[model samples]
Target: MTDRIRRLGMTAARFALSGALLWLLLSQTDASALMARAAAIDPRWLAAAFALTVVQVVLISWRWAVIMAGLDASIGTMRALRINLAAFFLGQALPTSIAGDAWRVLKIRSLGFGIGTGVRGVLIDRTTAMIGLVLVVLVTAPLLLARMPDPAMRWSVAAGLGLGAALLALALSADRLSGRWASGRLSGVAEFGRAVRGLLSRPVTAIPIVGVSVMVHLLAGATMWLIAGSLGLPVGLVDCLVLMPPIVLVAGMPLSIAGWGLREGAVVAVFALVGVPMDGALLMSVLLGLLLLLVSLPGGLVLAFPEPGPGQAAPRRIR
Candidate 1:
């Protein structure tokens, strides 16, 4: 009961925050101009953007399959893709982004894997994605710093870099730490850390996993770029690449429903630094968010008509 109440309170708070942010941003902008720009978007570019979004999801699902394979779970890419699509639907429906992760872990457990394996598989997958985001930000660090002269923005990027480095350092040293916790209640955590260490020790397998992870974010940037093109915005792909990683990292914070207002505000703020109009940025962000939601709708079908369980008969239609 207490947990339920706490969740409700959090959900209410996020709703309030997202509403407030959207109201604040919308109030300051030219509503007519924003609507006009949105109306005038080129359908061809919009279609292309939606297609790229689908590719991003598939690539992410494949990355998860690779991670599970490393852990010897072997769910196969197609099954993982189904699970990921379902999770994406749930993730967007729920207030917190991490909700989908919990769903993924549960789905894996249902597939007859131990809870430990499920948890570790999802954790490593998330960590690799985070690492990819951080690397994208760092690789474009020079351009980012030059583009956004705000001290706070630079510091935020620096903090993110530091966090990523610390994570890598901890994973590299997990072998020594895992032994200490192997017999404790936290053995699961120790096992997870060891798994991270094991993956790092094998570059041949690790490289492709991380590389695919990077491509996922790159594809996301491309989606944003295509959105810009759809709306005839002045922003370029390189600008999207520089601006997206951090904003995406922020949107994944679970502060609002599917990053509704937070993402729009970030898009406006960051893209403003690049000389794009605020309305254009907000429109692009809104379109991208809606397209993402649209693309994940297939997961609803997956949920409604789930795959048959092992040793169970598949559902049949009546003539």
Candidate 2:
């Protein structure tokens, strides 16, 4: 009972913080202007953005299936899609960024998969996707720097790219280091390491997953581009490619509810570097968030009517 109360308290705190930040941002902007901009969005651009979002989800689901296969837990693509969408919906709708991932882990475990396998699959999938986002940011770092007139912002972006690169290297090396340690306290770490190594050892499986991750991010950038276009913001695809990754990385942080205030703030700051109007950028970001929420609504149906159990349709053996 105490634990339950503590959990509830933490949840309430998170919601309060998210609400505070969102209110703060909205208060600073012209609410009337923001709504007018939103009202003026071109339906065709929004349609394209929506279409790209669907493609992004499907591709990401396939990537998850690939990772599961690599880990010797073979889930079908269709099932993976359902689970992914459900998780996505939960993640967005819930107060925490990890709500959907936690749901995915539990759902997979319920399918008769081991807890370790379920946890490892989700962790590795997220790790690889983060690496991909970092790579996107790094690859376009020079372009981003060139666009920034302020030395401080340029240096900040460069430092972030360096940190991202260093973290990626560390993640890649962690698996190898885990093999040398045998402490029981580190057993979980060892298990994750082995899983990482197992996935990377098979490039045939690993490369495609990473490749798809890059594509997913690129598609995400495209979606943002369309959103910007809808808002009549003078932003280009390259700008979105450079800006979206960092905004995404920041928003993925566990601070705000579904990245509401954090994403808007980041978008406003990043777009300012390129001379885009803050109000328009904030509006575009809000639209993108709403579109994602709309796209994830199908997951509610999956949650209501879950797929059959493993006994009904046995999981395929990992090849």
Candidate 3:
């Protein structure tokens, strides 16, 4: 009951934060202009962006399957797709982004895999995707840095880089650190770390996994470009490539519901650097969110009418 209360409190806090941020942003922007931008959206471009959003989820789900393969667990791409879609919906509906990840882990666990393997697969998948985003930001660092001459903005970028580097280091060295706990009560931790080391040790395996993640981010950028185009925003693909990663990185934070307020704020702030109006950027971000939700609607259906394979019973509890 205590844990449930704590979870409820956290959810309430996130809802409050999301509401406050949105209120602040919406108050500053011209409501009429925002509605005008929304009204002027090009259906053709919107459709294209929605299609790309579907592709992005498929690629991510495929990456999940590949990650499972590395862990010596094989849930074919189709199965991964089902799980990814359902989790995607859950991620959007739940309080935090981690909820989606938890759903993925739970689904995998339900497939009869040990809890340890399921956790490791999801962790590595998430870590590699983070590395991919970091690589994207670093690759375009020069352009991004040149555009932002403000010291504060520079420090924001620097802090982002520092955090990315730290995560990369921790992921690479987790196995070594797990050794100390090998004989301890935390056997699961040791096993997870060793699994990470083994999976990433092979160049052949590691390269493709990371590559897929990069592709996922790149595809997402393209989708964003299309979203901007739909709203007739001045932001270009190159601008999206250079700016969207940080926006994405920020939006990925679990601070708000489905990245609602954080994503809108990040979109407004980052695109403003490229001369996009705040209202336009906010509209584009909201449209992007709605379209993404629409694309994942199928997942809600999948979750509603789940099918289990013969001899495999779906676990009642997600732990």
Candidate 4:
């Protein structure tokens, strides 16, 4: 009953967030006018968009595996791919916060490893992955800043660059703090600290993971470009690449249900800045959301196969 209620709450939250975004988008839009504009798209492009999304899924899996491997969680590439696919599918079908993370955590648990290590490994992996994302925005921000055209986008770029710097500092610092605080023979808090410190001590270890993560985002941006192309919109891959990183940062925020309202609003704004029509951007956002949801359906099956264990302790994914 508690679990059911929790799921229901998450669903309701997601529905509300999605609903609010639709409302905001529609509030400024004339449905008839937008539909008329949308009629210009070729139906074949939509199919192409689906193909691009499949590519994105593949890339995401690879990136996830790479990050996990950095933490010494040695799941084979194929298994890691399955795990990432399962996590993504679960994230889309179920509540964004609960499902995707649960799938990852549980899959990691199934690997016949310590739950604590699996959890920490996933955490570290995500941190490394996100660090890579930040690096992308930082590295590319200057390259794209001069071409942003709009003052707001330029400002957005600046802000993103600053944030990326801050995150890098934190990741670099996390290891030192962990060493200082975790350098005891303790098993609880100290153990965690030691583990964190150990991971952080090898900054070189994280670099490759960060590089792969940036590549993953690039692939994802290409997927978005493909989607926009499918809709017959004139969106360049560079535009998608530049606009994608910041929007992802927004989507990761927990303020909205799985980041629905914010995702559309951010994408629409960025798209418009890049000279894509507002309505077209809006349409593409909706389409992308649908595509992701559809792709994640198999996560339902993955979710069903969660490892058996104690009350709430999930299984490991690597041996």
Best by TM-score: 1
Candidate 1: tens digits of C-alpha lDDT, residues 172-283:
4554673555657666566677787687578865887889888988888888999999999888899888888878977887888889999999999888988989889888
Q: What is the TM-score of each candidate against the true structure?
A: 0.93, 0.91, 0.92, 0.78
Against the reference, the lDDT scores of all candidates come to 0.85, 0.84, 0.84, 0.70
Mark the regions of model 4 whose C-alpha exceeds 4 Å error after superposition: 1-14, 147-156, 178-208, 304-319
Clashing pairs in 3: none
Which regions of candidate 3 are displaced past 4 Å? 177-193, 310-319
Stretches of candidate 1 off by over 4 Å are: 175-187
Q: List the residue pairs that clash in candidate 1.
A: none
Please provide, for model 3 over 208-271, each residue's C-alpha lDDT reduced to its tens digit, 9 standing for 90 to 100.
7888888888888898999999888778798888888988888888888888899999999988
Question: After TM-score superposition, what is the CA distance of residue 52 in candidate 1 from its true location, in Å?
Answer: 0.8
TM-score, candidate 4, is: 0.78
On lDDT, the stronger of 1 and 4 is: 1
Better of 3 and 4 by lDDT: 3
